[model samples]
Structures are given as structure tokens and as C-alpha cells.
Target: MMMRSSPFWPLFSQGIRHRVLPRSSLLTPRRTVKTLPSFSLENKTCVVTGSARGLGKEFLTAFALSGARGACIDLSQKDCEASIASIASQVQNAYPDDPVPELRAYECNATIESDVKSTWAKVVEDFGKVDVLVTAAGIVDNVEAENYEYARWRKMLDINIEQGHFVLAEEGREMLTWHNIQGSIILIASMSATICVRPQKQAAYNTSKGAVQMLAKSLATEWGPRGIRVNSLSPGYMKTDLIKGLLENEGKELVGSWERDIPMGRMAEPHELRGTIVWMASKFPTKPVNPA
Candidate 1:
């Protein structure tokens, strides 16, 4: 048999071939392997918006349980303190031996771009760097389209779509790129983006969520090559204070109506979304999940 050089032989020991791979080729291409990354948030720093209550507060607890330092960014300082305390208590109860992950609260109005930027800067200053960003600040306007005023519609878009979602994505991308950190950004969208809710009309809220879903998809395409992942988690109705008033007014009838529509037969709890949130923020190999 005659001897011939094989292309794959480059993978062999350099001592044998007395050859070195080009720096670009060595660093650019990664081997494709099937292995799940550890779903641990140990020592990671996360910045979460709208952490005062509801799903945002639940995320804070999840972060604490996963051993992540967190910055709870909400509109009210008092509310943020309450959220931080809640997370701390959960960590103490769950992992008594382990030191509770640091949790700080920042009063930030996400609707203001300057406030968002400053709050993120403060988070970076305190935590060294942010490993994950969660945009969870939002509001729902369940008013009839006919009665919806121009100001209300604009305000809804301003807060729900632009400040709460777009601004966070922009700032997070900047931070990730600057730090050269392969981080994840999770935007909170809603199932209403895909399906209109019955018995109530929230056109502004639905439209805002739909826009968020699209924004996340667009950013995923733009940022995937840069090692930063952007994903939008669109959750169904959840049992949280955000919708408590409406739930109380409608009582069991509306509850039953929504439950019948969903295969789960019930609304999700705030804690129910924690696992998915952790997975998204983990080192797992996850592609950008638009409307996830």
C-alpha cells in the first residue's frame, strides 16, 4: 500500500506531523458535540427588570435558588426592597448551608432610556458584570379598541414595546459585546401576541407583545454570530397580581373560559416559568427561541 496524507490527519499530534494549524482555523471552528451544559447559575450575575412583583419577583427567587447574584430593577425602591427580601428568604430556606447569593435592588423606570442605561451601569458597577438580562417590565391595557385613546396607545407602545423590551435588548447587547461575554437575554412576551383573548380586548398589549416577539427574532439573527443569545419567552396567562383585579371581577366564569381554551385547563403560576427561565439563562446549548 502506498502512503498518502489525509486532511483529517491535521487533527493528530503536531509532534508527528511537525505542523501547526492556522490561528484563524484553530479558533473559528468548534467541534460539533452533543452534550447538555450544566444548568447551574452558580456565581453568575443577572439583571432583571420589573422585579417588584408577579413573574418578575418569581424570577428573582429562581435566581437565588440557582445561586445567582441579582439586581432587581423596578420602578419603586420600596417594592424592589420587598422583592429582594423575598428572594433572600427563599434562598435561606432552600439552601441553609450555602451562602445566599447577593441580591440588590435598583429603582428604575424602564420607560425612560436614560434610566435604563443608568440602572444597567449601576448593576455592572456593583456585580462586576452581567451574565444575563431579563426584560420583564410590562403592563396590560384591557380596554375596548373604540375607547382606547391615542395617548394610551402610544404610552402602551412606549413602555411595553420600546423601553421594556427594545431598550433592554440594546443595552444588554452593548454590555455583552463590551465584556466579550457570551450572555443570554430573555424578553418576556405573551401568548396574547399569537392568539387574541376572548371576553376582553387588549389590543395595545397584544400588539406590543407581538412586536416584542418580532424584535427578539430580529436580534437573534443579528447577534447570534457575536456569541450573544436573544430569546423571547411568551408565556400564557399566569396567576399573578398583574391580572388579579380582572380575575376577581370575572370570577370563576372567566377563569373557566380561559382554562377551557388551554389544554392545561388552568393558568400557569409565576413559579411555573422559573425552570424555563433558568434554562434560558444557563450555559445550555440553546438557539434563539422566538416566542418561546
Candidate 2:
């Protein structure tokens, strides 16, 4: 940032220097804060579910931008194709020379036990070992609690809750047995795990997130000693594609309430969550590894 002499600065400083005015009498120039450069995530193989669009797509891009080999997984092969093409194009433009990323698409219904097992087995086969797993794929539907269909409720629970468990369990087993080092498992949790979602009734979604919170802590404790770390992130809403329409429809007041609830004054952007995800995935850079 270039600093320029303000038209009034010399006059104001002259006043202060001559003891005619206090230093606070004039506005001071503010220095621009420099942003920290991104670190290398090269050689890390990460699996991000629901990479076809929205939050998932953002996560996939972030992983690639950070120099990691990424696997983009979603239910539809067509969606994955579009996602892969988009990511490839974006990375190629960004990096140009070192642009060809080791990213592939996979289709798996995370809710099914058999599907998770096969999908993870293939993930390991292709990537060698899973260093980081970002479980971003999920669905949300809001309906009056009393009139909520049982099938819909069950579907929410199975996909959001059971599916997370299956993926973690499958990957955890491999990381513990096949791999010699610890790995990280990050669950894309929501503030609903602690705070209640008002106005609309999403009892099923809330409950599923609540269950994930426990699952994360339990797995962390169980695997901590074995060099594997587990943690969950509960992010407030951001301007993701899924919620963009709602925010525009419901107006900013509905989103602004979260600022009142949390210390931050607004919802988190998808990439804003990236720092925490990477930190939790890898061991802390400055801190020594826990031998326990």
C-alpha cells in the first residue's frame, strides 16, 4: 500500500508540533494488514464427499488450491463429472504450469453400509492412504414437526448420522491398521448441535448433528492414543448456494441473528472454514506431536 501525504496532515501535524493542537485532533493513516501466504499440502490425499456443488464444491476447490490430491465424491456420476471439469478448469487457470491435480470422481450413497465400505476401499486403493476426510455431503428439509413424514425423518437420520459413522469407522480401521501414522477425520457439523434452530422445525437435522458431535468426541478419545485424531466443526450459515436463495428470500435479518448469537458479526464463507479443517487434519505445525 502506498502512503500519500494528506492535504490536511501537514497542517494538523504542524498544529501538534507547535503545541497548538493535540495528536488526536487529526485522523491518522492506517496501515494495511498483510495476509499470510498459504502453506503446502502436497502429497496429502484427501477425500471430500458431496463435491458436485455448493459447500462441497468449495471444499474441493480449497483442497486442490492448497496443493493436495483430492477425490470428489457425490451420488450422481454426472454431477461428479461437472464438478471435476469445473475444478480442473479453475486449477489450470490458477496454477497453469503445475495445474493438473490428482482429483477423481466417485459415486457413493453414504447412507448405505455396503456402499461406504466399497467406496472407502477404493479410495484407499487409489490414494494409498486417506490423510484427511471431509464429510461435507448432507441434505436438509424443514417441515412442521407434527406433520413430518416418518420416511423423511428416517432418511435424514440415516444419511446425516449413520452415514458419518460408517465412513469414519471404515477409514479409521484402515488408518489404524494399514497406515503407520495418525490421520485426521473432520465432520462438517452445524451450530444446531448446540443452538436450536427456530422458526422452522428441523428436529431430524438437529438430532443428526447432535449425534455427530458425540461421535466425533468418542472417536477422538478412542483413537487419540493410536496417533489418529478426530474432531468436528460446527459452522454458522454462510452464503453457500444452498442457503443463498433462502437468505435472499428471508432477508438479511434471519442471517444477522447468528451474529448476535456468536462473537463474529456474520456467517462464515466456505473457505473461511478451510483453515480450521486443515489445522484439525494435520498435526499442529509449531506444537510437538503427543507421544501419548
Candidate 3:
């Protein structure tokens, strides 16, 4: 037997009510469910500058692994072809049953505007369209700012900033015209753009990379409404041929000091950035959401 409580209990609970809900309703989610966005680059055509070697080749390999048909652009056609062949072999081995994506080599001096235009046109002719473009053709040098030669400084800016801009512009024209295919453009900047690297002076390189980041921001704003996404990838120190050479020549002690400063206590491998490159090239949301 249960004892009755005070009648005031009902009065105190006037604003509260309880109702039994169906088990199915209780189990159901309130919000609509959605599937995850795919990162596969199937049926996509990609163009990568500096694809002959180093980080550029790594980026191209990432795209290939994602099932993208690619055009490898570099200063030497032979080198580009060799890189593509290596990539083809790797891709085939990875996807033993699947056919390797078509990969072609293209030669172009990115610093030259006319050369960039012709090479991009040829790429479009061969691949029909470019869905993604990664401008990785750049060089770095270490020299004290005061002693840096004017010619060397000019060359640095020409190759990194100017060349990247021209190649990006040409790709933009191709994407905007012809079939008006919306595309993604990735500019490979550097961590030095944000922070001054120590133990070595690369004022020109850092400045150019900073400009590359700014260029991406400006283009993203200009082309966002047009369905093109432009972004810059600023990578920290990676173990590439360039960095390897530096470590060997600059002495292990000096380079090792910098390596110790890294959060991981070591330099990143080239393959570590492959996922990032693939994600950038793949279809994903590029729009900014309003907080309001």
C-alpha cells in the first residue's frame, strides 16, 4: 500500500507534465542524417606543376592514388615522363585489379607566361578538362638579405610567386571557359611564410610564399562565387631531396637543432602530406559559414 502525499504536490508541479512516447519514436534521431563527403578523385583530371621531382611528384602521386587522370608539368619533359612512369608502376601495384589512371607528361617553364599558356592549353586538349591544379614549381635559397644579389632575388620571386600566379591564372581561364568546369587550385606555399626560419636566411623565399598565401586569399574571394576554390598549402619542414641536401651540406648539427624544435621531434616525411594533398584535390566544402 502507498501513502498519499500532500495535495500541494499537484499545484507545485503545474508547469510540468509527462507523457509516454513510442519506443520507435524514442529511438529515432531528431536531426536528419547525412553521408560523409567522398575524397575520391575518380573521373577527375589534375594538372600539377613541378611534378618531375620532390614534393611536386609526391602531390602527383597522391592524386594518382585517388584515381585522378593527371598531367605532369615541369621544366624537363623527360624528367616528367620518368616521374609519371614511376607513379604509374606504383599505382598499378597498389590497385592490382584496377586499371591505372591515365597520366601524361608536359614540359613548361612556369616562369614564362607564354609557355604556361601553351602548356595548359595542351593539357586541356589532351585531358579534355582540368578539375584540379596544384602549383608546386618553386625553389628556395638561403642567403643573407644584405648580401643577396638582385638577380637572384628577382629569379626567386619570378619562379615562386610570379610563376605560380601565371599557372594559376591559366588554369582559371581553362576552368572558367571551355566547359566552364568548376575546379580546385592549390598553391604550395611554405611554413616560413608565417614564421622566419632560423639558422638559415631565406628572406626572398619567405616573402614570395607569404605573397602566395595572399594570392590564394584574393583569388578565393574573387572566384568563390564562380564555383572555383583557391587555397594555399603551407607545409612545415619535410624530408625531401632539397631538405636532405641541406642537412648533409649545412651540417647535421645545425639542421638537427631545427629538427629538435619540431613538435614531432623530427622532420615530416613527404608521404605524410599525401593525405592533405588528396583531400584538397577532392570534392569538399570550400564555402565559409556565417556565425550569425
Go through the candidates in order and give each one's C-alpha lDDT.
0.74, 0.68, 0.76
What TM-score does each of the candidates earn? Answer: 0.84, 0.78, 0.85
- The alpha-carbon deviation from the true structure for residue 157 of candidate 3, after best TM-score superposition, in angstroms, is 0.3
Question: Which lDDT value does model 3 have at 288?
Answer: 23
Q: How many backbone collisions does model 2 have? A: 0
Error of 3 at 120 (Å): 0.9
Off by over 4 Å in 2: 1-39, 245-265, 285-292
Measured by TM-score, how close is model 2 to the native structure?
A: 0.78
- Tell me the tens digit of each residue's lDDT in model 1 across 156-261: 9987887765456555566656788888888889988788988778999999999988888887788778888888899888998988877777678888888899
> What lDDT score is found at residue 226 in candidate 1?
82
lDDT of 3: 0.76
Measured by lDDT, the strongest candidate is 3
As for candidate 1, its clashing pairs are none
1-292 per-residue lDDT for model 2 (tens digits): 1111111113333222110111221222221223233344556777888778877787777766666677777787567767867876787687665534567677788887888887776667656788888788877767778988999999988888888888888888898888865766777778788877766577888888888788877887888778777777777677777787666666767776656765667667776766656655555633222110
User: Which ten contiguous residues of candidate 3 have the minimum total lDDT?
Assistant: 1-10
How far residue 260's Cα lies from its native spot in candidate 1, in Å, is: 1.2
lDDT of 3 by residue, 61-89 (tens): 98887777777888876687678878888
Candidate 3: residue pairs that collide: none
Task: Please give the lDDT score at residue 176 for candidate 2.
Answer: 86
RMSD of each: 15.8, 18.4, 22.2
- Compare candidates 1 and 2 on lDDT and give the better one: 1
Q: Which residue segments of model 1 deviate by more than 4 Å? A: 1-37
